[model samples]
Target: MWIIGFLLVLGPLVTLHELGHYLVGRFFGVKADAFSVGFGKELAGFTDKRGTRWKLSALPLGGYVQFAGDMNPASQPSEEWLALPEEEKRKTFPSKPLWQKALIVAAGPFTNFAIAVVILAAFSLAYGKIEIPPVIAAVSENSAAAEAGLQAGDRIVSVDGRPLNSFDELSDVVLPNPGGKLTLGVKRNGRDLNFDFTIPTIVERDRFGNEFRIGRLGVASGPGEVVPVGPFEAVGLATVKTVDIMKMMVNGIGQIITGRRPVDELGGPLKIAKFSGEQLSLGWREFVSFAALVSINLAFINLLPIPALDGGHLAFYAAEAIRRKPVGQRSQEWAFRTGMALLLTLMLFVTINDVISLPIFSS
Candidate 1:
């Protein structure tokens, strides 16, 4: 079940991500040397009429596309790239205008985001959107809200000066601020007021005993109604949801880097497989929803400013634009090498974290 779920969830997402790059590069007249789903040894593949080797490789964690005149799948320019004949150079990725190169590099991550938005939109269409009022119905004793002098019947108008239309928006602001202070704009008895307090942190445990640290204001919302939305509204809501998830990811990573969150909170492929299998067992809806979350995660990770990733290439392009020339080849090579090493070390750490959190190790 685990193996099946992992493959089912990751396979299409990774393939489409690479396809995004391939399609855009092709559109710009850049010739692709190879398109691979996965890394390492090639398990199965075939060459196309355009001489592009489309292959399914052994490792299935991620994938890449190698453009003409590229050194490897990472798309670093080959040393021999400059020596290529004029006709051949024209087809290589490096020969493209700077803007075109940036678009090709960015297409992969944006494609993942698009996939997530589509999935979420489908879900919204199937099940009406949940619309909850921002009014506070109850406040937990001694909780953050109570400590801040909030009471039942208080209508939350905003958080930290940002206007809130629904209770759902509150979580988007609060969840990412564990142990952080926040200001709340409230309306009570038709009078406007403001309250400030530190959000309380709580450790939550799932049925499987996995623990998560989160922020809690300890206020209960009124029972929300399901409001049917049109297709356009569904897409808009899905886009908002995707952006919210991305924001949470950014906050979570910032917390980890600042030592506000434990490093063990980070998980790699093993953890994903475990969750994927569990969600698959639940039903198709759960499984597909999990896949959407993973898709957004992939998009966010690849957009980080790290070398050997899409964002890294975009970073170099930005530098090129500023200086009006490509960065020195030696500098790019060394930066890529360093970035690859950092990624590998982080992967190893997260894998170890996942393994130790497994049932067998826990027992």
Candidate 2:
């Protein structure tokens, strides 16, 4: 059941991505011959009345769309495309204006962003949202919170005399102040305990190859245990949630490039499936949140300037617009081949990490 749900969830995201290309390509008068969800041997499919072949393949991992005159799966056009019959050449993707081609490539990632917004809205409306109080759950041994005399069950009323509402607020205040002291008004057993503690900074990693420095108090915070918001308040809260996640993702990527995070944590299909199964067991809300996070990730990834991806193609089109001539085919082909090799290598590495990181393997 978990596997089935995972497939259904990922399938639409992949299909929507391909649909973005299909829609934009057709709008630009380029013929798209096939839009397929998944790869490998075809499981089931039927040619549409419009002549586009819609297919479901054996692997439920990812999907693609084949444009008319595309010479390969990477969608590179051949010399034949340039020499085609005049009437038919009009339908080739290479014949589109640079701006239209750029838009066609950019559509996939933007669609992922749209998916995130919709999911976030639905989750906020349905669940009323959970928020944790600014209470300390546990302090790490010999850590900053413990050294500052913070203990379990201390209801943090304020920091520096400012009233605190939720755990999210507390984190925002603390995360940037690692190894720095902050005044805390804690309500204990019928008494207000005023104290000062320095929060420690620890490095953490997210889904992307990025690292972040987070304040460590060694406590767990959750929804409603701290503060809760209603429906209208929830939308603003949801938007903030989306924005915060995006910031963390950006920071993580920075850390990766700076050598602060290792590549081992970078995950691929196996990691996603593992996470999907785990979230499925947790129920609908958690699964929805997971999906939202992945959606944001997809959007960011597609924006990267790597050949064979939306971003890569957009870069080429941008250059064409500026220089008044497309990049030489040989140069584009070499770049694409390099990009493909790098991508496949990264995928394989991440999958290995996923397998090795399993608890069963640890024992």
Candidate 3:
């Protein structure tokens, strides 16, 4: 069942990605020969009215659409295609204007991102959101909360005289006002404690291993209180939430690069499969959250400027747009090869990290 669920999640995402390319290509009058949902032996397939063969392959990791003029992505067009009548050649992807080609290549990643946003919006509306009440759970020794006279068990009723219903609301007020004095109204020991507290500068580690200063008040939040929201509000909140998650991911990647964070924090396919299986046990909500997270990861990852990725292709397009010419096929191939090597190395490294990080593996 876990395997089935993983495949279902990945299969649709892969199909949706390729469908983006196929639809955009057709929209631009480009001919696509094959649209596949996986690699290796075909499990099921059918030719569409446009003569495009859509197939489901045995493997489930990823898939692609083969455009007519793309006999070899790195190879120059064949003499046959070049000699073809101008009308026919015009429909070939290689013969399309640079901008059109770039858009076609970019559509896949864009579709993934768009789908993620829509899914998040839907999920947020359906499940509602739970946020931590603006309540302090504890104050660490010598921490900013301690210095601010925050008690271990205190309900933060307001910040700087503004009533806050949740810790999330307090964060909006506190994070931006870091290092500045603010008035806090707390309910503790059957009495209201009002005090002026200064937010402290906190060091946050990024993905690549570097640390940056941010605001902090060593106060822990309790479990979130679920709040229902309307569709419009859900959509707005989901967009904000998505951006927030993406920021954290980008920051984390920076920390890893700076060596402040270990690569072991990264997980590859193995970790995802394990997580999918575990989420399956917890029921639908956890599974949906896992799916949402992976979708966000997909969006961010494809945006990386690594060749063979959507971001890499976009980078090439940007260069072409600047220089007013396409990159040579050989150069593109070389860049793709280098990118593939880097990607494989990273994948293997992260897979190893996943194994090491798993307690079961240690046993």
Candidate 4:
């Protein structure tokens, strides 16, 4: 069941991502030879009106669109591509305008983001939003909130400069700023108070011995409510949710890079699968939310200026735009090779960490 769930989540994401590139490529008059969902030997397929071979492959892990004149599915150009007849050359990705190439490459990740936004909006409208109270019910002794002069019964009206209508919204802000002082606005009785205090980044361990570092405010939120939203309102809220999650991810990565958070907490495919299974067990709604988070992560990861990714291609394009010439093939190849090696090594490392945290391996 878990394996099935994992594949279900992976398939649509890959399809949507590749479709983005395919659609944009077609729009720019660049021909795509094949649209493949997964890799390896083709399991099933058909040719479309545009002569595009759409197929499903055995791997089931991911997919890609092979453009006309691409050396491989990775879109590397070849000698044959360069020596093509002038008419054919115009139909290949390499011969397109620089901006057109960038757009086609960038469309995949942006499409993933769009899918996430739509899913979130639909779900929000159906189930409504879970709204937490902004009122602080209690403040723990000697904690950040206590030291900041926060008291029980105080209402948290805002954090930093953002106004909050719910405690969950305020929590989203405070949770990512651990060990950093933040300006907080609270309403105590009839008077407003402002406090600045550093929140603690506490290391917490689960029953399975997996550890996580999270921000602790030492303040408890009051009860929560479910606010019904119309489709339009939910769409807007979904956009907000997407942005907030992106910020959280950026900050979390920065914390890890700066040595403020443990690198061991980083996860790989196995960890994500485990969580996906857990979410499935919780309910369909939870599972959908988990998928949305993954979609956002997909967008964020692809946008990083690393080689072999869309962003890497964009980086080369940026250089081309500035110098009025594309980067040398050898340099681009070496950079992509290096990036691929690093990404593979990191994936292996994180998978090992996931194994260590498994109950079967834990001492």
Candidate 5:
């Protein structure tokens, strides 16, 4: 189940991501030499008529597209690329215009985001939108809300001065701020009041025993109605959800960097496999939802301004645009090498962390 779930979730996502790059590159007349769904040794594949080797590799973690004149899968330009004939150079990625290159690189991450938005929109269409008011129905005894003087029947006006439209927005603010304090604006009996309190961090476990640390206000809102949504409205809502997920990802990474969140919270391929298996056990709906979340995560991670990533390529393009020339070849080579090293080190750390957190390793 674990292996199957891992493949089911990552296989399509990785393939689509690479396909985005391949399609965009082809659209720009750039020739791709290879399209791989995984890294390392090639397990199985075939060469297409266009000379592109479409293959499945041994490692199932991630994939890449190697374009013409590239040194390796990272898309570094080969030293001999400049010596290629004019016609050959025209079809290589390095010979493309800055905008075209950027678009080709950006397409991969954008495709992942699009996948997430589509999945979310489909869910919204099928199940309708949950619209719950911000009014507090109850506050738990001795909880953060209770200690902050919040009471039943109090309508939450805002959190930290941001106006609230629905109770669902509260989690958006709270979940990313474990142990952090916030000022709440509330209205009761036609009067306004403000209360400040610290959010409590709690460890939550799913039925499958997967654990998560999150902030809780210890307040409850009435069960909101699921209102049917039009196709357009569903798409709009899904876009908002996609953006919200991205915001949470930014917050989480910032917390980790600032020491607000533990480094161990970062998970890697193994952890994802575990989660995929667990979500698969719940049913297809839950599994699909998890897939959407993972898709957004892939998009988010790939769009970071780190070298050897899609965002890194875009960053170089931005610099090229400003400078009216590409960065020195030596500099790009060193930067990519550094980036690759950092990525590998981080992957190793997270994989070890994931292994240690597994049930077999738990004391």
Candidate 6:
């Protein structure tokens, strides 16, 4: 079931990502040699009229589309492609204009984001936005809220002068400033009241043993409203959600790099596969939601300006655009080799982290 779930999560998303590259390359008049799901030896395949071999491979982890000029699945161009006949050169990927190449490289990540947006939108239309009221259900005894004179049934209108949309909005004010004072504005019996209070810091460790400090107001939220959204509204909301997740991920990465968060918080394929199985056990909708999250992560990771990624290709294109020529082959080769080494190291570290986290292996 875990294997099935893993495939279900990665299969369509990877296919769509490759399809984006293939489509854009074709649109730019570059011939694609193969469109493959997974790497290595092929399991089954068929050739189309355009002579592209579409194959399902044994790995079933991720995929790539090889263009006519590509030396490998990594989309690196070769001297063979450069030395082609004049007519054949026109059909090769490297012969395309800078903008065309950029678009082709960018399309893979773009497709992943597009898939996420669609999935998120569909979920919004189905289940609607979770709208928990800002009202306080109960203030914890001797907690910050209680010390601030917060009462049960008090409706929070704002925190630090910022308007509150839901109870979760309080985290925006509190999480960043542990042990710092905050100004809370509440609506009690048709009257506005403001209180200044200090946040109590709490240390929390995630599944991967990463520790973080957060503040707790010690108040439970009231009941929530489920507001159904229209298709267009859902799409817009999904886009915002996508952007917000990306921002959070970026911040999280920065935090890890700065030693504010642990490096073990990073997850590789094993962690994701476990999550896929867990989500699948819950239900199809749960699995789909998980898949959407994974798709967004893939999109975000691929767009990092590291060599061997789509963003790396786009970066090369940008340099080419400015210098009126591509970066030298030797330079590109060294860049990709370094990138591959870094990527492998990251994967190995995260895989070890994942293994340590498993119940069978844990202390």
Best by TM-score: 5
Instruction: Report the CA-based lDDT of candidate 2 relative to the real structure.
Output: 0.76
lDDT tens digits, residue span 1-363, model 4:
567667767778878898999999999998889999999999999999887999999999888898898774235678898789999989999888889999999999999889889989998988899888799998999888887778999988878866878888777877776777677888888998888767788877754355667788899987778889998899999999899999999998888899877786688888877777767777888888889998888889998888988888888889889999777877888888898998899889999988876768876
Which of the predicted structures, 2 or 3, would earn the higher TM-score when compared with the native?
Answer: 3
**Per-residue lDDT of 1-363 in model 3, one digit per residue for the tens?**
557667756667767887888889899999888988899999999998877898889998778899887776442477778888888788788888778877887888778766777778888788788878677877778987788788767888888888878888777655644456778888988899887777776767544233355567777787876788898888788788778878778766775777645576688876677677767667887777777777778878888989978788888889889998778888988998999999999988988887786666555
The residue pairs in collision within model 5 are none
Model 5 per-residue lDDT at 29: 94
Candidate 2: regions farther than 4 A off: 72-77, 128-214, 218-240, 256-259
Cα-based TM-score, every candidate: 0.94, 0.75, 0.78, 0.91, 0.95, 0.87
User: Model-by-model lDDT, in order?
Assistant: 0.90, 0.76, 0.77, 0.84, 0.90, 0.84
- Per-residue alpha-carbon lDDT of model 1 for 223-324, expressed as tens digits? 999989889999999999999899889889888999989998899999989888988988999999999999999999999989988899999899989999
**Model 1 misplaced regions, further than 4 Å:** 72-79
Give the Cα error of residue 311 in candidate 2, in Å. 1.4
Candidate 4 positional error at 66, Å: 0.5
Q: For candidate 4, what is the TM-score?
A: 0.91
Model 4 spans with C-alpha error above 4 angstroms: 72-77, 130-133, 140-143, 161-165, 202-211
Candidate 5 lDDT over 238-336, as tens digits, reads 999999999999989888998988898999999899999988988999999999999999999999989888888888889989999888877887888
Provide the global lDDT of candidate 4 against the true structure.
0.84
Backbone clash pairs for candidate 1 read none
* lDDT score for residue 15 of model 5: 84
